[model samples]
Target chain A: MKLHELTIHEASDLLKKREISSQELTRAVLDRIESVEKKVDAYITIAGETAVKQAELADREISRGNISPLTGIPVSVKDLICTKGLRTTCASKILENFTPQYDAFVIKKLKKAGAVIVGKTNMDEFAMGSSTENSGMKTTRNPWDLTCIPGGSSGGSAAAVAADMCLGSLGSDTGGSIRQPASHCGVVGMKPTYGRVSRFGLVAFASSLDQIGPLAKDVLDCALLMNAIAGYDPADSTSVPEDVPDYTSFSNKGLSGMTIGIPKEYNETKGLDPEVSGAVKNAVKVIEDLGAKCVEITLPHTKYAVAAYYVIAPSEASSNLARYDGVKYGFRDKEKNSLIDMYRSTRTKGFGAEVQRRIILGTYSLSSGYYDAYYKKASQVRTLIMEDFKNAFKSCDLILSPVAPTPAFKIGEKIDDPLTMYLSDIFTLSANLAGIPGISVPCGFSSAGLPIGLQLIGRHFEEKKILTAAYNFEQATDFHKQKPEI
Target chain B: MKITKDEVVYTADLARLDLSENSINRFADQIGDILEYVDTLNSVDTEGITPTSHAIFLSNAFREDEVKESMGADKALANAPEKEDGNFIVPKVINL
Candidate 1:
């Protein structure tokens, strides 16, 4: 296999054996990106020169007998994560020229591990949409088919990994942003428990629901990335003081004693494509055949998830985004007369339609007269949803479901209808709401040849369990081995 | 659920965003649809359930109160759209 095509684990082994140097691997990946980037549009910034320099440094570290699993590995970061001196736009025009002076905690971790920073990937503006079409810059197409979306707001990261542009990627999930894209792109994406990873540098979406995790070609690679980034940091108050395990150690554990629950409500979801349902059922049978029991379960509050998420995510976004007024940083309008006029004009010009729509929705919901009816009500319902997951976990070790209601839809398919787009994330949002670990692994493909993903969710901080299950499924199947022909 | 153009304008004003007449109508219709869907939460009985502001049960995080170095003014003002000496420059707020 080419250097660009090697998973992080495979590439690390080759590097350790002195079979390939980090500079060569980084160069091969950069060459692949240059060849296919126009067709894939997977990155917002390609830090080619810096990546090679970093890889050379990693090679020197390797020669000195100092190395981590991620040392010399090339990884892409979603544009939402802060990377010092690199333009991190969140795919929004407001901060198109904004650059951070310091790295995010996760970026600091990746740098400390000697990982080569490849570039920043695109996303839905402010991570408010399910598809990257909301990106103010460029539309990131699914690698499998140029016409379909690599389900987003982490679309570019998933597409980058699927197209072999990067060994692995870091993506922040607010509500299925990571998993849904990984599903559509046919890779492994994990959204760890809410506080499992620090949020000190992630561009805030929904403060309570957002978490940064890894997207890679395989589950083991995802786990390796997790080990480097997870654990508590004093910088973020919400970060939990939980001990992170040796995630790579859980890779080969079989599913013999595990009891997987299939949420009956997921099967009954309206508009769920029959092919996706079939693929998930087949995956469950495969796991059962491997000596695990699959029992039907119910998260009774499933239907309320999307409803509650809309209110809660947007409410938080409105408050978090209020800092982009006109002075401190980002774009400012010169045509406005008054200070308030400048703020209004700058925002109106800087934000996209979807962002404007969400801001308005959030502002409306949080307004004094309506707060009790909308924001407060959503929070209360969020409690019920969390309780539902807590109760369901009592009967099973992990819950199995389809990551998304269907495989990726064509670009511009649901962009016009905001409600239709929001419903697409129905299957993946609850994991975020419940603050549990969830992963998407390639299961099968639609007749149209689009990738379908099977989701496994575990209780909070149970990433190792879900990773093990996903790795077992990956080992038993060749879905992850198949790559987009781009 | 039936958000009127007036309500959209009101909300936009509250958000400190300027919306054109065309956008006002569009936002009103779109936001009305989303609000209608979100209104389903009202149907569920949440009588005694405490509102969950966060997914995890995290208390106030405490840290050492000792002073530490912060980002220098040059770096802090790196991305400022307009700056003066060592401060971000904005529209005049006080007439006096």
Candidate 2:
């Protein structure tokens, strides 16, 4: 059996009922990783012994009558998230060997919930790039189409889930790293509301925009993982103080009376493929068929989302990434004879060119002279975009759109043109900038056979609403049923 | 989307990424083009609208000052490329 394809809820039931041990599930995922990870390149660090130990512990716990929703399920952490003793590279060479002394807030929660972490998935360096191609490690290929990319930063997590390497995985989304890859790989990815999930253990990328979310093959599985991870952490000041409910309840009622809003500004963008647009439109129809009301809402400042994000994210990135000087922590070059030379050489070698470019842009925007012209203005515009959503949400419960302009593009297609690469994030960046919950659920595949995703956005802290809509749509469609041929 | 090598050097300096003349020239052309394309957003009239940075409506998420439990030194150094005295070891930086 392809055990990794089973949802966490499904696998946990069997394990809890004593049908199979947690170690069996862990070994199945590990065996699949051993057999398939070479082609997918989904993991930068695969934890075999630790995973086995955790599974054994979980098995013992289950035998001792310990049962939890997440018990005995194998999950992967995006390499950007600190995994206690595991190397959290963020796919950057500078931190290639740096391991954190503490578990990220989500890690602590998952461990408590009995999730057996299988491995650390690959990601774009510091969660910067939109394509896994920008990761200093090997490019993470989309399980759906090996020639194409798995969307990025969180590409490895998405690819791993789709390829059946893990039942579910954690992915940090800054500008759609989680959702875009989920779209590219034909899986489910959820970027929980900012502060909905604590950010304590995630290596900072764009601090304001970065969020650790779940990516799985189905909406329920994503919810199962999110429930374990989403809660306030004292370490992250941005963590919310609100109560987190069992989000799986949304799957029961579906999308009745939910207003699915379609933003008009998103429809008029250039490069939006007709096929992908049609798929989202059809998904909307399916949602309506399930008794939800589809409405047209306007987020007037939508056009400025990308521009505002470009300035804000880069500026934050510039500040957040400053800690990686060769002198402090992580890899320092043995060749550098001088401190300055070491700083330059270590950073130059550690970071990919794309990450370097953003850090520079961010630094420039935040520089003494240019700060007012860029960073401040971007922050001001950030408020405007928030207002637009605030107004739009007055009439609707959620927003629907395409996750990417098209299905997964071939590897190396837009890497040379940073603008084209930036444009790839256009559909995804708005949610991050707004700090709202966004998910990409499988809507359908394109004519060329690449998987397409339907983006569902919800009000801040209203992830249950979005997941409910997604779960209902998933029930009415066959998109999630189609697995990768690999 | 035209960019000059000087702009590349300027941005690199701002980013603290020291680059060679060759890399500067290469990134200049690429980043410059991206900047130009992104300029399309300028046409958007954000005149009165406040920019949005986070999606969660809640603010003031700061945590109370308190020490939390941490991993033990041996486990913490599991991925350290260099370690000594149960801490991450690095080249001397700021002299104490």
Candidate 3:
């Protein structure tokens, strides 16, 4: 394979053997980005010079016999993750020119592992939408088909990996940003358990639900990226002090003795395309043939997950986004005559339509006399959703479903109808609400040549289980080996 | 569940946002639909079930009370649109 198309593990092996220089790999990736970035629009800022410098530094480190699994590998970062001295826009105009003063915890980990950051990827503005079309910066098209959306708000990262512009990338999941995009782009993405990775310096979308994770070419690359980023950090209070196992160590442990629960509710979801469901069903048959037991299970509260998520995510978003007033860093209104006018005008102009809609929804829900009816009721339903997963886990080791109801839709398909777009996230929202770890692995393709992903949800902090299952499935099938003809 | 333009304007004002007349009507219809969807939560039985503010419940992470080096004023205010005397400049809060 070409240097730009090499996975993290493959590139690291070649680097360790002194067969390929990091400079060559970085240059090849830069050339690839230069060639395909116009059609993909996967990146907001391209740090070509910085990547070359970092690759040179990595080469020197490798010569000294010091190398991590990610050393000398070029990776993209979602624009929301803070990189000191790098413009972190979150695909929003408010922070378009805002450069962070310090690296986020994950960025620090990636840098420490000697990974060269290629650039920051675009996303839905402030991660409020499911499609990257909501980005104030640019739209990231699915590399598989330029007319289709790369599922978002991590669309750019997935597209970059799919198009081989980067070896791997880091994307955050609030509802299903990371996994859904990965599914659409035909890549492997994992949303590690809540608090499995630190959130310090990650622009908050929904503080309670957001978790940073990895998207890569294959399962092992995802695991390698996960190992580098996952762990406790004193910088983020929500980061749990749990033991993170060596994810790569769990590979080759086949599906024997594992019980995969197929949620009945997932199949009953509205708008679930036949091709996507068929792909998931075929994935289950492959797992069952690999000596795993597939049994039907019911998550009775599944229907309420999307309803609960909208209320909770937006409410927390409104509260967390209150810091972006004109007085602080970010855009300001020069035409303001009064303090209130400044705040109102700056926010009105700085935020996009979807963002404004969410902020309004959140404010209305959290306002006096309405908090108990909206926020509290949603929280109560959230408890039920969590309990549903907790109960399902008692009967099975992992729950299997389709990552999204259908393969990627056209760019402007669901952009106009907010409610229709929200319903598209029905299958993936429950995992975030429950704070469980979930992964999206390529299963098959739709007849229209779009990729479909099979989701495997595990109990809280049971990433090793899901990773092992995904690794075995990948070994038994060639879905992940297939790449978009970008 | 049907939010009016007045409610949208009121909520936008509460959120410190100035919405145009077009956005007011648009947002009212959109948010009203979302609220109506979320109102489905009311049909479920949640009596005596405590609300979940966070999925992974953890107590406050307290640290030793000690002064340490923090971000310098320059770094903190580096991205500020307007700054003076190492402080972010904004419209006057008081009109005496």
Alpha-carbon local distance difference test for all models: 0.93, 0.84, 0.93
- What order do candidates take by DockQ, descending? 1, 3, 2
The C-alpha TM-scores of every prediction are 0.99, 0.94, 0.99
For model 2, the superposed segments whose C-alpha errors exceed 4 Å read B1-3, B44-96
Q: Can you tell me which runs of candidate 1 are displaced by over 4 Å? A: A251-253
| Prediction-by-prediction clash tally | 0, 17, 0
In angstroms, the error of model 1 at A253 is: 4.6
True contacts kept of 2: 0.55
The superposed Cα distance between candidate 1 and the true structure at residue A377, in angstroms, equals 0.8
lDDT (10s digit) by residue, model 3, range A1-486: 788988899999999999999999999999999999999999999999999999999999999999999999999999999999999999989998899999999999999999999999989999888889999999999999999999999999999999999999999999999999999999999999999999999999999999999999999999999999999998899999999899998858578899999988887788999999899889998999888999889999989999999999999999989999977788998898799999999998999999999999988889999999999999988898888888888899999999999899999999999999988888889999999999999999999899999899999899989999999999999988887887
lDDT string, candidate 2, A1-486, tens digits: 456667787888788779888898899999999998879999998899999999998988898999898888899999988877787888887887787777889999999998899999988888888888888777999888889999987999999999999999999998999999999999999999888899998889888888999999899998888889998777787788899998988755567777878899888999999999999888988888898888898987777777778888888988898777765468777686556667677788888888888887787777777676677777777777777788999999999999999899999998887777878888888888888899999999888888999999988888988888888889888889898887
Give the per-residue lDDT of model 1 (tens digit) for A147-197: 999999999999999999999999999999999999999999999999999
Candidate 1, lDDT over the whole model: 0.93
Q: Which residue pairs show backbone clashes in model 3?
A: none
Best by DockQ: 1
